[model samples]
Structures are given as C-alpha cells and as structure tokens.
Target: MKVAIVGAGLTGSLLACFLARRGLTVTLYERRPDPRVAQVERGRSINLAISERGLNALRKIGLVDEVMADALPMKGRMIHPVTGALDFQAYSASGDRAINSISRGALNNALLTAAVAADGVSVEFEHRLVELDSAVGRMVFATPAGKVSVEADVVLGADGAGSAVREQLLAEGIVAENVDFLDYGYKELSIPAVDGEFALDPGALHIWPRGTSMMIALPNPDKSFTCTLFWPAGSFDALTSASGIEDHFRINYPDLLPLAPNLVDDYLNNPVGVLGTVHTLPWQAHGRTALLGDAAHAIVPFYGQGANCAFEDVVELDRCLDDTGGSWARALPLFEARRRENTEAIAEMALANFVEMRDKVASPVFRLQKQIEHTLERLLPGTYVSRYELVSFSTTPYAEVQHRVHRQHQLLGAAAVAAAGVLFAVTRSRARR
Candidate 1:
C-alpha cells in the first residue's frame, strides 16, 4: 500500500521514517525547496524546547541522540522582576529533569535525511500540494513541470496551521476547524553572546515580567538567547517611531533597553507573530486522509508545548499503525478518537498557562499558590504531580493529568484553611495567659 504524507516538516518526515521502517511505501511532499539547501527562514526561532513528548517521538526512530548532540538543557524558569533580585524556580522537584533546546531547522533536516535513508520512503521537494481528492484517494501536486497526480491508498496531512489538505478534507465532510486568535501578539528579539559566552543565565528560561506585557528569553546552543516580546497588538504599532520605541522600552522594560543596544531596530524590523488556538474536530477523513500535528490541533506557544506536542502526534500515529496491523482504515479513526480529547485538553491548558505565565506568575498570592502546589507535588509523588510535570516529563495522558491536578488543588485549599485555624487557636490561648 502506498501512503502519501503532505508537508515534509517535523511530523511528516518523522512519520515517513516510521512508516518506511514497517515496509510501507511512503511519498513525502513538501512545498518549499529543500530547507537544507535553501536559505532558512529568519522569522521563526532556529531552536525549540524538546521535552519528553518530543523526545519520545524521536526515540522511536533512533534519532534522539543525533538531535540532542547540539541541544542545551534548561533546568528551570528564571524570573526577572521589575525590582529586586531574580529568582530561580526549578521545574522538577528533584531539579534534575530538563527540557532540551534544539535547533528546529537542524532537526527537520535530520528527520528528512533519516526518512530518505529508509528503504520504502521517497521525498520530493518542491512538490506543493495544490489539490487533494479525498473520495478517490488521489492528490494533485503543482510540480516544476506542471501539475502531477498520484494515486494513494491512504494520505496524511502533517501540514501546519495553514493546511491545504485539511481545507480539502473539510469540504469532503470529514472534519471541522475553528481558530481563535489571542489579541496579544509576539515579536522576536535577539541578545547575542558576549565574548563567545552567554550573556544571561544559561541554565534557565529567563523572563522579564512587566505586568500586562512580558518578555521571555530562551537560550540557544550558540550561546545566544532569543527574546520574545508578548504585547497587545495595537500597543506595538504605537511604538513605530524611533522616539516612541525608545520611550516605550524605557518605561516598560528599562532593564532590557541597555542590555540590547539595538532593541529599537529589532523591535521595528521583526515580524509580529500572530498567536491563535486552532480547534479542529474529527481529525480523520474516513480513513483516506488524516491530519496530524499542527494540522489537527495548533495551540499557542505560551505553554512552550507547541512543537513538543506536535512531535507527540508522530509517536502516537506510529503506535496506532502498529496496533491496527498496518490497516490505516481502522487505525486513523481510532487514533483520532483517542488522541482528540488529550489534544484539546492541552490546547485549553496552554491557553490558561498564558495567563499564569504573563500575569499570575508575578502575583504574590499566585506565587504562594504555586509554592503550595509544588509542596504537594513533592509530598505526594504517585498520587499528585503538577500538570506541567506530566506534560513535560512523563507520558501521562494530558486529560488525566489535568483532572488530577484540579483534585490536588482542592486538597491544598483545605490544608491551608486547617493551618490557618491552628495558628488562630494558638494565638488566642497565649493572649488569655
């Protein structure tokens, strides 16, 4: 049986590698020229944080070590307050667990190489998927010579947020998709290494919290850090002029202005990235075509789980294929039926985390709550673990993880009330004496 996978990005390439290993003939199509040979896009970050979910996918095809060779480990979040000293909050209770920072372009190229090396896999660069006919199991690609058609027994769309195959599948009455955009957008900035050394804390994910808006920096292997500025869309345009940009930074992020000499230039020139939540329904198309990765569900990057979660789709798809004995007709729908709830659960959690990261993380009461939550995670290892831990470190299903975290929070509230009562009773007896 021949399977046609669309979009040779991370998911598509990895899926190709797994399918080919099972002796299935797979043809991977990508619109852009070979990224390895072409100029890499400057907008998106060159690297991403590959946690457990992503690493599990890469481990399936023995490419985990190759990807990790250049990755940097980030142990925790480094909170930089407007006033006072910076604080380090370890992600794992033991402080040993970490998420790896890897170059996105490099990883994609690596997967493509691995897929091409497989016996039954063939990759075609510059084969833009122009049209997909789900009913007939056929695809039409706009190639250099002109339009080319290929017949397939099954097709999978690993295309990203803007997916052509998904649009076609919806037309065929297989899927429904909705997108909600966050009013706040993001823009990229850079802090180059100083004298070939990291300018900031290399062991943590640094953040500059400015109340309503915030800036975060993630370290790269090259000793540089990529800073992402999250602000209201309309607020950013007001700083178009040089003086306006300078004045805005001076007031909002006074600390960053001096450290980044060309802050204004980078802010004005860098593209404003649109943040949105893509809620897609019924990710399978009657066994002929199915959507994986971002094509099925795309969440905002506030949780830093976007890429990692996409990598997870690859691993899950491989499992589905194996369990169904290579019969995609049964595997695709079962995959969607099982993975859908978890994907949507994380999508909602990711949105909630935006509020936690940007506003709540700085709140005193919220910080106390986090402390209590961390304590519970430490006290009850098997019974209770933070949602972040399950998503980033363990293989627990996202929906189950979220459910348990909520229950644990209730217990924490009761504990706080009892402790307060004990303190009040002790104080009253001392006053009577």
Candidate 2:
C-alpha cells in the first residue's frame, strides 16, 4: 500500500516508521523544515513526559532504548509551596516507576532519523499540504520549488492540533470538530545549569503551585530545566516592566526568581500559548484517510498523557491492521472505535488535573489524601491503584483506568462513612455511661 502521512512531527514520523515496517511504501510530508537542521522556535516547545505507553510503542519498533538514552526519569512530583519545606508525591505506590522527561525536538529528530533510515519510507520536507481529497486519496502540496501533487492508497493526518489535513476534511464537510480552549495560557522559560550541574533536583518533576496559577520544571538532558508557567490568558500582559515581572515572581514564585537569571527577558519576550481540547466527531473518512494524535483529539498537558496517548493510537492502529489483514476499510473504523472513548476519558482527566496541580497540590488536605491513597495501594496490592499510577506506570486502556478509579473512590468513600458512624456510636455509648 502507498501511504502518505501529513506532518513529520513526533507522531507522524513515528507512524511512518511503523507503516514502513509493515512493508508499506510510506511518504511523510511536513510543512516545516527538517527539525534536525532548523533551530527550534523559542517559547513554544514544551518538554514531553514519556511514560509506559509511549515507550511500549517505541519498543515494538526497536527504538525504545535509543530514545531513553537521552531521557531523564522523574520518579515523583516535587511540590514547591509558597512557604516552608518542599513535599514530594511519588507517582507510583512502590516509588520505583517513573515517567521519562525527554525534549520534544530531540525525540522528533530521533524519530525522523529512524523514519528516513527505514526501508520503503521517504520524507519530503517543505511540502505544505494545501489540498486533500480523501474520497480519491489525492493530495496537493505547495512547495517552495513549486506545487506538487501525489496519489496514495491511504492518507493519515497526524498534523497536530491545528492540522491542515483535518482542515481540508472540515472544508469538505466530511467531519465535524469542536475545540474547547481554556482561558489559561502557558509560557516557556529556562533554568540553566548551575556550575555545570542541575539547578534543582533532577529526580522529580518540580511544581510551583499557586492558587490560581502554577509553574512546572522538567529536567532536560543538557543539565537544564524547562520551566513553563500556566496562568490566565490575559495575565501575561500585566507584567510589562522588569520590576513588575520581578515583583510578581517575588510574591508568587520566589525560589524560581533567583534560579532563572533571564526571567525578565523570558517572561516579556516569550509567547503565551493557548491551552485547548479538540474533539472531532469521526477520525476517519471514506476508509482511505484517517486522523491520529492531536489532530483527532488534542488534550491539555496536565496529566502528561498527550504524547503518550498519541503513541498508543499508533500502536492500536497497527493492531487493527493486523486483525483485518492489512485492509484499510476494516482497520480504519476499528481503530477509531477502539480509541475514541479512551481519548475522551484522558481529555477530561487532563483538564481536572490542571486544577489539582495549580490549586490542590499545595493543600494539606490534598497531601493527606494522597498519603491515604498510597497506603491503600500498598495494602491492597493489585486491588488498589491510584489514578496517577494507572495512567502513567501501566498500559491499561485509559477508559478502563477511569472506570476502575471511579469504583475505587466509591468504595473508599463508603468505608470512611462506615468508620465515622462506628466512632459516633462508641462516643454516644460512653456519654450515656
């Protein structure tokens, strides 16, 4: 089969590699210049947290070890409060499983290299997809050299949240999409290495949780940390002056102020990126074209599952093809049916985690609850698993994780009520005596 994949990004490049392994002739068309040669645009790059799901996909393609060589494993979240000492919350009950932090650009470049080296795969850079006819599997691209047209047996849209291929599908009225943009925006900043070493502990994902806004720092392979500030969309505009920026950090993120020497410059110059969730009615059209990754469903990054979920989509799609004996007609619908619910569940969880990270992570009650959850997980072993553990450390389907977590919470709530009632009865009996 001849496959054309739009967007040579992380998902698209990785997908190309997967299809190539299946003996399919695949061509990747990317609008942007090759990431291996171009400098990354500032302020927009968010580091990815690669967990089991992402690694599982890479393992299948024999790229897991290569990718993890540059990744740093973060075992837990290090909560930096406004005052007092720092608190740590391990992601897994056993405290051994961790999510790997890897640069988005680096991972993309690695995948692109693999895709290029894979047999039966070719990549065309600077090919901006301008037209796509899913019904006939024909695509037109505007290149710097000139307009180029190609025909393929199958086309996949992994172009990301603002996918041009998806736009063409919308224009043709083949699919419906709904984008729910959060009022918040994020700006990326840097905390360079100090004395040739990391500025903070590289063992955890550092979070500065203010009530309404939050900042998170993930360690990079270069011994630096990529810090992102999530705030109200309009709030970034309020800090225009150097003093204003410094003062805001002093009051909200004091520890970060001294660590980031270029704070003022990064704050003022960096662009604030909008956060949103994209929901598409159907990810496939005419059984000849399909959407995957962020194009199909774009979720916020709070749960750190955006990239992981996209990787899982590639795995599931490959499995569908295996089941259908490489028939696109049977595989496309099966892929969508299998992924839609899981993606929806993760989208909802990611949004809810935003509130938990920015507001609840610093609360005493929230800490106590996490302790209890961890305790239960240890006591019950396989019977009890925290939502964070189920999502990050395991390959459990996202929809099933959501269902299991709900049931566990219900049981815990009932147990608590029963214990409270018994205590009240004992107190009443003592009073009567």
TM-score leader: 2
lDDT tens digits by residue: candidate 1, 1-433: 8899999998899889888888999999999999889998765766678898888888888999999999889998888887777888778777888888788899999999999999999988899898888877789999898999988988899888888888988777777889998889888888888889988888888888777788888888889888998898777787778888878778766667766777778888888888888878888776778898888898888777887888777778778888998788889888988888888888999988877778777777976766766787788877778777888998788888888778877887898899999999999999999
TM-score of 2: 0.98
| Candidate 2: stretches off by over 4 Å | none
Per-model TM-score versus the true fold? 0.94, 0.98
Cα lDDT of model 2 overall? 0.94
* Best model per lDDT: 2
User: Model 1, stretches more than 4 Å misplaced?
Assistant: 418-433
Error of 2 at 209 (Å): 0.7
List the pairs of residues colliding in candidate 2: none
Find the number of clashing residue pairs for candidate 2: 0
Instruction: For residue 111, give model 1's deviation from the true position in Å.
Output: 1.3
Q: Report the poorest 10 consecutive residues by lDDT, candidate 1.
A: 40-49
